[model samples]
Target: MKTSESLLAELARSGKPIGVGVIGLGAHGSWAERSHLPALRAVPGYELTALSTSSKQSAERSGQVHGVSRTFGTAAELAACDEVHLVVVAVKVPHHRELVRTALNAGKSVLCEWPLGNGLAEAEDMARQAQSSAVPTAVGLQARSHPALAYARHLVADGYVGEVLSATVVGSGGAWGATVGPRDHYVLDAANGATLLTIPFGHALDGLASVLGEPEELRIRTASRRTSAVDSESGRHVPMTAEDQVVASGRLPGGAVACFHYRGGMSRGTNFRWEINGTEGDLVLTAPIGHPQLSPLALEGGRGTSTGLAPLTVPEHYVRVPELDPRADAPAYAVAHAYQQFLRDLREGTSAVPDFAHGAARHRSISAGADRLAEGGRIVGP
Candidate 1:
């Protein structure tokens, strides 16, 4: 009978729990298990009540593994459950639109993973649904929650680093080119699935856009494409449709041009680094410690001083919020935090970010980039 805010405050003060349902039971879903479930258990106001999977067996397995009270064979069943006030969709790109619509239409809040939809049309349609339904929706853009990046932005805005001149982000190391699972096998074919370009590249670019602002001109070039030794479920070498290595250049609104070099299959160490250049100084954004490559919603940066680049410490505030299971050292826990934030925004009446519009814009960028590649690397916008 308590109001949502009052309940949240009470939970924060007394360690109560919020009821939540999670959809999908794959690697990302398993992430929900290792990360979200524990974090939600640690948070003040959260509870894992239900989970849904395409197969009942998978749902049962997830339910047992995550310690959830119930398991539903389908997303709709989970959405309609009275015990579930929030739904977390960690499914594939293809199923996002339908599962999200189901949860929203069922009067449940939703937290969907990245790339809201596979294409612009799907993202636009999903956004329209979110708008019309008035249901709170959160997309996976956790990098915005990072603290080091936050400090960088603050320094930039405050002119600690003078007006931005230009920037470049290079994310290299490891071979994501090899097909990992049955669900992601489609990714090798650009036409069938969203590959590094749409998934990892999107995250990298989002980080870039977050610090630099929207780009005025964007151009993309893929060096080469070839099938790897990785075999798909179909027993054939999945055809690599998109370029595994891509170089995208863009001019920020302030006339600062940025270049991004991404190599999926490389021998270098697994590192994600970004740099921002200005008239006064330079800032190097490095992956934060404590959280894994994908988990740190917070980041770290190096600011140039008169002598050398000084370490800029940005507090990790995004994961600091109190939850039922307050365990650290796990990146998967972020998905739960991301989910809880989505529902918290809904219950608290704040604007949900990376909603339909954000997803649509990214989708547009993807489509536009593909078009440019087809047209021999011309500039385009989404």
Candidate 2:
């Protein structure tokens, strides 16, 4: 296996960029156009080659807007396109399986968004297929790829904080509380499998694990305070079955006590605050609102000799590419980091990129968290 260092040398030695085709580029104002488009254009070792949508007309429109001449009416066509080396699946969680399977069957690499599938079974099935296909794969899990997180991991390893004693995270769930639009109504139904717990909390947990090691076990308490949401598109009340709040406590793999609580909806209070206390010093990551993936995080640290925390800027060396926008907390900004890493991993044959196995690992943890929620906050081992 080539070390990441060797991969860097190899990439520097070769100048060709990886070709990517995005499935479900979405409509004019969707996340694909807003985030992925900008990100693909900004990253150095990537070239956007094709676009795919449900209809030929929509695909042509998106292709023209995005400057992708080769557009496909369906994912199967995109997957079989010779120009595309990597297939990016950004559609709804429910459609991930078929699209990803198509890409894999065509021997194309893929980068799928988080919650890899609608549920554990679906996620596992996808993971299993990805393994059998033997193609390089990546999950969105962009939070883990953030530069701030990269810096924190280095700091923790270097003992900026002597030994981690405990950590706590409190965050909000954005507009998932009481009101939602027709477009977002699907998320409110627990059966859809894209709920507050699965998306936001799951991403947050992965981010935490990226900085602090994964928790070996956890005990959880999950609840829903709102029984209904006003559908802004229909102007009617819709019954909601998804959870709006989750609280859990556990032990990190490194033996630090970890506590996490996520509340539904937007809040004026401390919307996102994560603190890690150590024997000698402490590190805190905070944001103005929830959705860590979309919120810029500021890192602060303090030691016993200091009266208060001080801003800690992430060193430029932690980032894979200096071309990436380090300022924005938006998806486009953060996701570029993972894209660069995926390209590097693809070129170098390294396992640094989070693949299907990694996604399945996270799914197991999430499934256990759900079980813990059901069983009255009891610890469950990995």
What is each predicted model's overall lDDT from 0 to 1?
0.64, 0.80
Report the Cα RMSD per candidate.
Answer: 5.4, 4.9
Question: Lowest summed lDDT over 10 consecutive residues: which window, candidate 1?
Answer: 373-382
Model 1: per-residue lDDT, tens digit, 59-111? 88777776665888999999999787668887767888889999888876677
Best by TM-score: 2
- Which sections of candidate 2 miss by over 4 Å? 1-13, 321-329, 372-382
lDDT of 2 by residue, 255-316 (tens): 89999889877777889999999999999999877677766788999987997899998887
TM-scores for all predictions: 0.80, 0.91
Clashing pairs in 2: none
Highest-scoring model, lDDT: 2
Error of 2 at 292 (Å): 1.8
Q: What local lDDT score does residue 354 receive in model 1, on the 0 to 100 scale?
A: 60
- What value of lDDT does candidate 2 attain over all alpha carbons? 0.80
